[model samples]
Target: MMGNRRPFKAAIIEFNPCLNNLNDNIKHLLKEVTEAAEKGAKLIVTPEMATTGYHYENRRALKPYIDTIPGKTTAAFEKVAKHYQTHIVIGMAEVDVEDGLYYNSAVLIGPDGYIGKYRKIHQWATENSWASWGDMGVPVYETEIGNISMIICMDASYFESARIAAVNGADILCFPTNSTGGSLSMLQAWAEMNGLYVLGANRSNTEKGYHMIGASTVWSPNGEKLAETSYIEEEKTRNETTIIYAEIDPAEYDNRSKRRLQSRQPDLYGDLMLHIGPWDFTKYELIKEAEDVQGNEMSNCAALLQYTPVIGDKKANLSKIKSLLKDTAAETKPKKGLLSLVVCPELSLTGPVHSLELTAIQQLGETDHDETVNEMQKLACMYQTHLVFGMIESDSHALYNTVMLLTPAGDIAAKARKLHVTESDERWATPGKDIVVTSTKGVGRVGLMVGYDAAFPETAGVMAVNHADFIIVPSCWHGDYGKEMALHTKMMENKYPTNTMTTWDAMARFAQAKTLIANFTGTKLGCRGGSAIYTLDPIYGGETPIVASSDKEEVLVVAIAQTEKDCWFDQNKLLLSRRTHYYRPLVKKFEHVPMLDCN
Candidate 1:
């Protein structure tokens, strides 16, 4: 058994295979595996459909390339694994000969021979046209090197795939993909959020009409890139073969993984399992068409107030907030039928607190009936808009970091206490239990989250499952902290800064929801004020923030159109595509993974 014996090498092979050329592709894959194994890589992975290639016209076109487990392809890979005494993961189109079913699958081969396989669960639109939905659930295999899990190309787009692997005790997530855009950021977010290593082996060059960006990468548990291939836009440079390696030490960040598991409130994630969207795949029927969908035609003018709050000075902060609200109301008037939404940063009333003392927390905390809330309600009424902002709420003896929504009707529509709290918040604030989504006059259903809560995909996922049209975030988020900063820097360098708007952008794309984040500009308090609004980009199948703020105080306003026409597939097709029955691990209490020493 390879029991926690220091750090071992892991390799990701980025290769572009010829369509339907199985023999040549297998020969090339074997050569790469041999080279990586000789270079001391105990764990080696290849891109999705490495042997057969991606983007087939239909099932008949792919049928010739499909092989059953323990078939010829597995036999060839098993020889390499046994010879090198290494574990190899390869993506291929698998056919269950008995059932005559085809699936996009990844097979894991150990030194002993065939170990296990994970069928791609979440299918992209193109994949749905041919491959059947993965029937085998996400599985983690206990190996001497540590627990390992495998997920294919499109599965990386969904948070539940990685989250399930993590909860199942996977130390390393091997992702083999033929994905084109924004793939690295998605992998990094998965690594950071799940607190596990993500090794993505992506193909290079264009297959058919789909251009796969060759940036195979290995991410540490902290989401830091250990190694990555260059992502050149030039078609010629994109086809180059590359092999990136990173040392895998499963125990290095086991604590972070353990903490994430312990902090998960699975009971509150019931929505994740329910078919609660416009279309229900369980019934194989469309509940609403694009035009018939409620709130699709409604456009709301939204303003994000990015400003530093005067610490411990609620009166001053309220004055500045009110001034901004008044200016926003006057400057950007919504159309006659549209509504307006104004969002403020987390702890906008009292700012971020440095004191950990209970008395200090209690003194700074306010109730829904407090003068500050009443003042905000008055502003909402006066401006004839919905106001969203964060504050410290004192409910009896407990202190919670909460985001409140005040409607133009002069009422508190919804209040969502932050479910995922930072270390500093643990000293003075209690983590909330419920996820809140409120239906409004024109905004449809608006969901609420605060600062760090947006970092967790499940939080937004719950809101999305509840059919939230707009997910508003009141955050004091800083740009310099967290492992995501590495990804943020990389994204900024690539001129795709919107991809760095926290994990909310990815969630917005997956959940088909609009996300508006308002943040503070207090450098001293670790807030860098990168407030923005993210929406689904139909052209690229990703997300782009329509309006963004710098590290300075400013009120940015834009008209946000929430439409079902921008759905990932058909009207609400991505929502309908979710295989919730296979997601039992997500809502269950995490069990102790045997491979890692949590203590």
Candidate 2:
């Protein structure tokens, strides 16, 4: 029981923790533990602040409720662990008797004894009241089944914590959370990104007037929702407490664990590590963008298809894209001379987004000469229209997030790789170098960006400098619709928060460029489906700038005039603003500075 290295079942308890009532909470928890162990779970996990509950007034109010590491709470769970021959992770408010500090902590109790504890490093909004930031760092505990590590609720928000745990050889990243919506995808993404199993134990029901949405779930390393218990389902079943069970095999994660870390580009990610705070603006040279004269007439009609992509199914994905292209071509045949290009979502061939198996991705990865690209090229030639789509491009050693442009003659006119890649992308694909803008027979100079590249202003800035008349964004922005939309709104506002502008609109209008954004739509990816076409001026005669937008799968065809008009937002001259030298912090590395120091 102390040392067994075999695949075993695990359980995550989703229950309501009574505020400041450890007795009732422990009794309910033990009941779940008994049932889980009876059902053959070798490891069991619980939600954050499982015994003491979350939300305390302050340190003074919380200290009385906080207990020591091997205090009465763990002692009780220890008995259960010993009785069941299983390991248990229990979350509670921890009081360091020596240091006299409180922490949001999770303790690992094995059959042998108390294994270890992990303090929650990243604190959420209200948690700063009593909890001190964790100092133990991310430490892993080796057991017979696998190497295990614990991360409290807010810690999962930062990808670095999970990355740190995985880099240190953690097979299972156990999470104790009091989280609700918008956090689920982040958990799933973390599991897929790190190639480690995740047990997300979230609290359910109302606590002191605050409702915690319970969706306790377990995710496989590949981002598969192995088992889950949602609040809606539980309410229908009239179940106040639920335990989601899963079977984990450490061997399943071995290959990806090595591959994902190997693919990380830390050298290019130094900017991410740099933290910025309020600074003196007068010290830096501030220059407004110079006004630009409207360029020559460059009108071209385009179609943006917000179709769903099938994950890891290359043949099926290609067939879908081809069918859509053919259908779109037929619909626009009467105006064939007008429609210049069709844009598809990122990784349209093998799925715009996926928490895919590394081996499957490598096998499905296609080279430029592969049949995948040739088929798309043929489609472009047959229609006599340019086509741009995303796919997994691979060479001998690496995979790339690539967008391929096909001319009407069936030739690969341009290939642009995604420069800014997410953790999910880094799991399998290598980040691309350099922004590429290429001239098409009818489409004018077009710049390509994939997914998160939209987050960086410099990406669009560089493309704008190249005289691009149009930018095609192929995105795999997957998550809950409302939550992802909120995130996008926040990201778009970070730089220009006071203006309340969409990043895509700002990027397009400020750059004096038109944009055709193609996004995937489906429950499979859980991505917020935001596909639209934007121009400087409204074509439909509405105040809104977007020409066409779709929340679901649809063919959005928009006809643009040949003349490129100066963008409405361009009147502000933000794009032409020449403070390039003053923006050194964006490209150069800087030490982590507290955005707001409370000293």
Candidate 3:
């Protein structure tokens, strides 16, 4: 797809449709599209439901605005697309005359006329009252500008909708949304995670009681904010139309998609298709609460110990681990019928393998019955707390980077090998082949993931689909990596000041699970401690308070209750709303596609 073609310009229109006035809305959209096309924008997109207002009470209230795909809206936009020799994507309310059903849809038109259409597959709460679930699967259209795909507002909340399009060879994703706060972060994550350009066109002004937050944005494949609009309420209430533009060169980001696709392990993602509702935990009794537990009981406490370990020094690292465990136990008194989980960074037992030789690294590996495990088991039993930490495991003729969960019963509850090994681990470690999730007495089901595995969404998605209440990541994430560096530069340039922590938070929110991340501090391998517990607010999405984070050694603890989990599942049925049938491409075997340059 990347030839000698030059970079092409794309535009997004932040529109405010007049309620029950289809004529006025269409006229406004046409004027904006024509203006963008006149300015040499090869592609232009509008906000979702651009022909009709977003919030209607029921089908009867929205009935007047419903029309066929090529009936009037597409016909109006087609003239502009053909006149300027460009492509246009517009969102509208569609009615299937054959069945008399309604849908929230996005239609694409080029110089040749109507290209294709995509309905809102994942509907928001209000949309369920009138619109039918999208029957059309994700579609990508071929054009001279790029291979383009469209997703409505709520569809961007789930990674699967965008992942499927990327896997099918989509270079750019057009997002037509009416979402408010926290949408910018979601768009950036989607763009970086799938390695594709994302153009978000969000509406302005208030519809009914729903106030649109107008931060229409353009994001590059590396998660850089190429362009964006105002999110101020005062500005949005003016109902002013805004147009933003960006120049995209698909060739520059070809390697990112190549590496992302090449690193995927689809065989481990079968659980994604399972219909696992959140309430299924109760039926399965995944988290066995104590019999004496009261309805208003305080939540269990979890802690993260962030510290740099000496390379190849197992004795010092193990001693430091014991000291930290002892101090934390003394501070936060462990109570009966309550759970206490403590996590440490990756390879906390034997330190990182940065400058160590293969033979030296192998010698640092510990077995199940080694003194290192014995000492940790003693600490777990003595403190009456569940302990999670990473270590280099020595097996028969092989060494693996492994995370072990030691229950308060003085036994190894679960051990997971790193599934996605990094460059350092590749020198002396073998990649794990499966995802691990285990049911603890008080923590519900706990999923285990090592450092690099957190970078892949499928690892966490599989666990959440299998009903994991909490996901623990033992990471040694560095700031010097190429992708991380790019993202950091972009965040600073935009005054956002976020890091890879947003990635972890986004994964937790999409999975509807709480995530506890433990990372090493100090300069070893450029790892700066950012260990924190990420929580989900059903109304506000992922929120990272960063309970305890620093560039130095520290012990961070936070109380997590069952109420939060219950509230999330009760209010937001995110897991139950998944359209699994359309996720088949995610689990398919990988093959090189040179034309798409994803090898």
Q: What lDDT does the true structure give each of the candidates?
A: 0.77, 0.68, 0.78
Task: Write one digit per residue (lDDT tens) for candidate 2, span 192-214.
Answer: 65677989888777666555667
Each candidate structure's TM-score, on Cα atoms with residue i matched to residue i, is: 0.89, 0.57, 0.91
The numbered model that scores best in lDDT is 3
| lDDT ranking of the models | 3, 1, 2
Please give the TM-score that candidate 3 achieves against the real structure.
0.91
lDDT of 2 at 253: 54
Candidate with top TM-score is 3
Supply candidate 2's per-residue lDDT for 532: 67
Q: List the lowest-lDDT window of 10 residues for candidate 1.
A: 282-291
> Any idea what lDDT model 3 has?
0.78
Model with the higher TM-score, candidate 1 or 3: 3
Across 1-599, the per-residue lDDT of candidate 1 in tens digits comes to 44655789999999888889888889988988889999989999999889898878789988878889878999998988998889999999898889888888999999999999989998876777678899978999978787889988777666788888888877789999887655555787788777788899887688777777677889888777899887745355466578988998756647564465666777878778876554445323212322233453445677899888888888999999988877766666544234478899988888888644667767888888997788888888887888898889989889999999988887989899988788778888899989998777655578898888776677888877766777898887764223433442323222455325536566666566788888888666767777777666522543346545455778877666554364444315656667888888888866655445524
Candidate 3 off by > 4 Å: 1-4, 182-184, 234-236, 277-284, 287-299, 334-339, 480-500, 538-544, 547-550, 565-572, 595-599
